[model samples]
Target chain A: MGRQYEIPIGAQHISLLEPLHFKFTTENEKIVATEANVYYVHRGIEQACCSKFKFRQVSFVVGRVCGLCSISHTTAYSQVAEKLLKIEIPLRAKYLRMLVIELDRIHSHLLCLSHVAENSGFEALFMKTMQYREFSMELLEAVCGNRIQYDFSIVGGVARDLKPQVAQSILERLKKFIPQLDELMDIYKNNWTLSLKNKGAGAITKEDAMRLNVVGPFARAAGLAIDVRNETEDLLPWKQVGFEMITETSGDVYARNMVRLRELYVSIRIIENIINGLPESALITETKAFPDGEATVRLEAPRGELFYYAKGNKTQILERLKIKAPTFSNVAAMAEAFTGNEYGSAPAIIASYDPCLSCTAR
Target chain B: MNKVMTSIENLKKDIGDFYKPELHHFMVMNAVEVGDQIEVQWFFSDYAHPCDTTCFYTLVRPETEIPSIKDIVASAWVAEAELVDLMNIKVENTQKGFVLEPDFESGPLRKKK
Candidate 1:
């Protein structure tokens, strides 16, 4: 119905609270192309890591890289330094690490689901998601002492040990969340407007997804069955704690939503299993320091694959520290996926990826 | 073979045949007064693949003759240029002098004397 139009959205807006801007070039209401302005608030975390902190101090610094995936950043840093130091963490420590990471996944995904419901004008559904999210958040606060940025990881092992009472409390809360999530899932699946808005709105083929190398929920939505946690078996010891990697062949906004929701259940199950067989040992491993060498570690963050590379010269200070976050890698694909989609669905489609721009920028 | 031996052997095999040919690609590589210079490691990536970590040593100061790896890895182009600009590492036959920002003299990472 139209030839050309310019739709300019902000680095900040009412619905999309994060500092990210998108300018859509459109024909009628269907977006033909899009462009983005990134690094507007680039805190220069990498540069700061290289210059400001000594080796030990960098862990605490990078943990503040992204609030939502603080564990992922810290875990990646710790794991890389562990390789450099040539020290193997204790068995109990490894399981605890997995438990905390699964908890982070649950914590992040619930917030994303609620945001989606809120954006779609489903007030009741949004409230339910928020209510369910509180249980996870409360458990996190009880375990790690802070709900938002849990500085629970140190160089060799975890910062805090899980007391029996705390573990039991978390277990009970997770038990309460399972049936509530299932009920919410039924409502989302049946909602006509929600399905219509999400389904096939931002579809990308499997081949394109592979070429773009989308990871996490976005990759799963494209039917790629790759999960770093499953691949790294020594990290997770439990047997019956099962999680089927959820995927949707449609590769649309709806598929992404489905993948995230299903993953929520898997994360809760993983936590339950960890508590059932909590290991016995000291939480912190003996630390020497990072040696004169370079180490790189890859971990599956809630968004996608996170890579942390560190170079140490056997000194207290690190020579180089580089972080490659998921959003940076997926930026191109996001632009491609949004093309030809209706401009009205732009906010919802972008929100479907549940982007944490802080993670991307840092 | 034993577990340790097998891991060592796997690593040796992973280094591949080009270990000798590609040895001369590093320059101005060493830790600055960080105890002893135990080893210098190299993180190499081919035109199409991800970077693979390798090692260079003090005994054989890797050939500093060749240009930096800007052609092979696109991302490292800016990084290497910045390194040269800041650290004053004289990379021979290097094209395009500065990467971070020209006229920005004095290194930010160096310890104040």
Candidate 2:
């Protein structure tokens, strides 16, 4: 038997973007086992949303769960809250929500791609990706008036209506972005340097992904074909906004990068469709009703499926609130995929997973 | 979207019969307190149809040892460990602090008495 050594990385590490710790047991250069401790950032947000916040205020509170997927969290909460009240939002509000979500996906996927590039020792490509990502952040600022916590979604509907100028600007910027996205797709798909560091380094099989019940790009990359957007039509009308499922068969770091890269094309398409056919109506639904029953929502966050469950008893405060971030579901598989891989490529693999720990730990 | 109320004893067979990885994707395990009991629900989605959902739930006392569905669904381990750590629920082969530190005084979501 080869000598085994246990190596621990981060509750804080240079390569780890989140406050998560992983302990890997290695024999020579290959990992044999892995353990993860990822709750260092847990802030009891769920409890706060239930006890400290009113039904109307909980939408903004849940928005803080993860900066990257702030829109997803708030939108899901609003949808569940809408369900509890038994009222539907305006078609205009639904279209605006879809617009911001696709924009958020663009920046989020690029950020993940940039981190993956940086972790793989390709600093130049990382820089290039980040430069391309800035446009989405600026667009978000114009639309929602904030960069991190858009607060775009409120209880009954969206907080702001899309101005014609802003809509036109969005289309213009996205038109310019298409060529940039195509450029990124070519580099991610054909780049020899990235392939060496990522191609087969960290891999999980389709059966393993299904067994683990993985979601989002992690599941899609493994050929699972699971996306909340592809499933539910009762909420935001994802199909009408041109939402499409993107998947890759490899289930490795390389395949994950490709999935994120290719999905940006779909995101761009959704944004264009939303802008081109946005309906005109009231922004907020103005419900005087209190949430009186149980409701659950499943949303496609940048990383994976974000689930929210809430219960109310005709009171201002919710009875219970649960936020299940995508990373939490993948935590088991995160550990499982590390086994039998060279420890040197761990950083890139971790980045490819695109974890949002604050969302999970909340 | 349909929800069924079941118990810990039937958790395995109920979920085992319902879950086929190729056909269904297990979603999540959710918990909420109602009166003196905790209501826990298991969620699953059909892959082919995508819109068809099956949820199996149970209401139990706070101390009940809920059976883990890890054997039936591999990813149930995280959900099981999370319920133990945050909701203070008891489940087989799962430990607390999977999401919270072990020394924390109480489960974060446990209702204050």
Candidate 3:
């Protein structure tokens, strides 16, 4: 090693959104080793869910874990809680849950792509992407009556019915977004400047991804055919609503961006199908019984597979609640993938990984 | 989900026999405090099969030294470290000041009488 140096970033940094720290050991601008700390924002939510919140109300509490994938947390908790209660929600409720989830995924992916552009020193592209992303946020606000913490998903089912006018507006907006998405796809796929910075940066192989138990787009970009949506058709009817797995082979930042962009097309199709084939049924399955057994639920959050485990004693409070976020699984791969990249490219690479520390540290 | 109970000694053999990275994806290592002992469960998902989950667990005291499975499963370190900090799980060579503050003497997850 020629003139090795230890460089520390975050716990607080401009490029990072959450309090995640990484100490990179670099030699001549190439990262040789990386140590990461992701617990800066850990807030005992699991313990609170077990002790403070009742089993029925824990869904809302878990929803606060991550702003981006709030619905994922709530929906996962609801599913696990449903299993514990041994109650089956209506088909309409399940489809609505899938609806909000796909909407959330669209915005979350766009936000990540924008950050990648921003961190890659392409501020103009970042601005352009964010401008395009506004539609999803507005749509989410219209759908759930709130922008961030949707509070849309409850224990048995969704909170509100999808009014026809709102559904019509959603279709109109989605129709408008397709052209914009296509434009973005073209830019991200063909732009020479972006390709130069992201084509080979932060690449991980399929074998390494599988070894590290990587999930979501990061693993999908590396050619790993792993998705909770693909596996769990019992909980949510993803396939009935036209769910398709999107993958890219390169496993680099560029490929990741491509995967996210293309997945938006899939999301759009799912949303349309959900609206067109919108089932007519009760929004929730009311349960007077308390949760009474151990249950595990796996959901495909925007980032990756979000796992929730809960145990109940036929009482109001849950005996135990454990949440394993997507970023937790990606931590090893994140550190390993940084080994051969330049120090300056760290921000873009980190953004591309889409490290969700709030979810991880919780 | 199929759950099997294993001892500390047989844990390695059980994991070795059941786990193949290509076939089964290791999901998470979860620990829940049962009455007095801690119930540590290792969860895995079938990559080839549809919605099949295998869970292997061991009941041990908080002070018992748990073997690190990082060598067998590369991604075990993170969850192993989390259990160390949150549940006072005695996994050898794993750091504790993760998911909790460094000065905490005991895990917060341990129920108080």
Candidate 4:
């Protein structure tokens, strides 16, 4: 047997946006096993939602779970609370919700792509991707008044209405973004350095992916064909909004990037449809009733499926609030990916998973 | 959603019969603290029809040892570990401090009187 050594890569690292610690046991240059510690940023939001916040206020609080996919957290929590209240929001509200979520998905995926580039040692590509990513950020700030952690979603409906001028500006921005996204996709597909570094690295077979219960773009990359947007038609008219599930077969870092790049186009299309067919109605419903039962909600966040469970008792505070973030489910798969790979490729592999440790810890 | 209530003893058999990798995708394993017992639910869904969920739930005392589903679903280890640190529920084969620091003694998610 070859001599084995251990390398510890960060509870803090240059490549990670959020804190996650990994201890890899390497035989020579290849990783034989990996152990991940992901709860460095837990803030006890679940306990706070049940003990401190009211049913209505919990939506805004849950949005702080992760800045990248705050909308997913709030949307999932609100849907559960809405279920307990037995209220169907206005059609306009649903369209508005869909619009912002698609916007969030675009920005999140772009950030992950940029980080992948940076970790792959392509600094210029990283800068270019980040430069284009700002457009989505600007659009989000224009619509929600804040770039990150935007408190745009409320229990019964949205907090603010999308004015005509704002919708026009968003459409114009999206049109300009399409060609740039196309160029980025071309660069990612044709770049030799990126493909060599990532093409077959950290790959998981379809059977292993299913055994590990992987979700989100990572699973889809491995030919899992599991997307909550395609499944949950009753929650939102994703079909009417031009939603499509993009999948790739290889399940490597490169395939994962390809999946994200294609999904950006899908998200852009969904946003355009929402803006075109936006209905006119009240932003919120008039309901003062308290929550009195339990409900569960699932939504497709950028990373994967986000799950929320809420229990209420006609009181100001909730009885329990459970949030199972996408990264939480993908942790095992992340560790599995680390095994049977070279230690040099660790950063890129972890980045390819696009883990949000804050979301997992919460 | 289809719900199947089973005891800790019958969990392995029930899950073995219900879970088919080609048919059902394991979604999540969730634990909630009820009045005197903890409710643990194992959720699985079909990829073709996402709304169709098959849930296996069992209620046990906080001190009762629950069986681990890692043999059935490998990804369940993460959630099972979290339950040990958060809800203080004992599972058959899970390590502590997966989330909470080793120096910390109390489960953050436990209800305080």
Off by over 4 Å in 1: A234-243, B1-113
lDDT computed for candidate 2: 0.89
Q: Estimate, for each residue in B1-113, the C-alpha lDDT of model 2 and write its tens digit.
A: 68887888998999998899788878778788888899888988788987777889999998988988888898888787888888888888887767766887656788888
lDDT of each: 0.66, 0.89, 0.92, 0.88
Which residue pairs of candidate 2 clash?
none
Regions of model 4 farther than 4 Å from truth: none
Please write out the lDDT profile of model 1 over residues B21-62, one tens digit for every residue: 222111112212223212222332221222232343222122
Model 3 chain A poorest 10 in a row by lDDT: A50-59
lDDT of 3 by residue, A1-362 (tens): 69999999997899898789999999999999999888898888998998888887888899999999999999999999999999999999999999999999999999999999999999989999999999999989999999999988899989999999999999999999999999999989999998888999999999999889999999999999999999898999999988899999999999999999999999999999999999899999987999987999999999999999999998899999999999999998999999899999999999999999989988
lDDT per residue (tens digit) for residues A248-270 in model 4: 99999999999999999999999
TM-score, second chain, candidate 1: 0.39
Error of 2 at B49 (Å): 2.4
- Name the regions of candidate 3 deviating beyond 4 angstroms: none
By DockQ, the better pick of 2 and 4 is 2
Interface RMSD of 4: 1.3
List TM-scores for all candidates, in order.
Answer: 0.78, 0.98, 0.99, 0.98
Pick by TM-score: which candidate is best?
A: 3
Q: What are the fnat scores of the candidates, in the order listed?
A: 0.00, 0.84, 0.76, 0.78
- Rate residue A190 of model 3 by lDDT: 93
Which residue pairs does candidate 4 place in steric collision?
none
Q: How would you class the docking of model 3?
A: high
Is 3 or 4 the stronger prediction by DockQ? 3
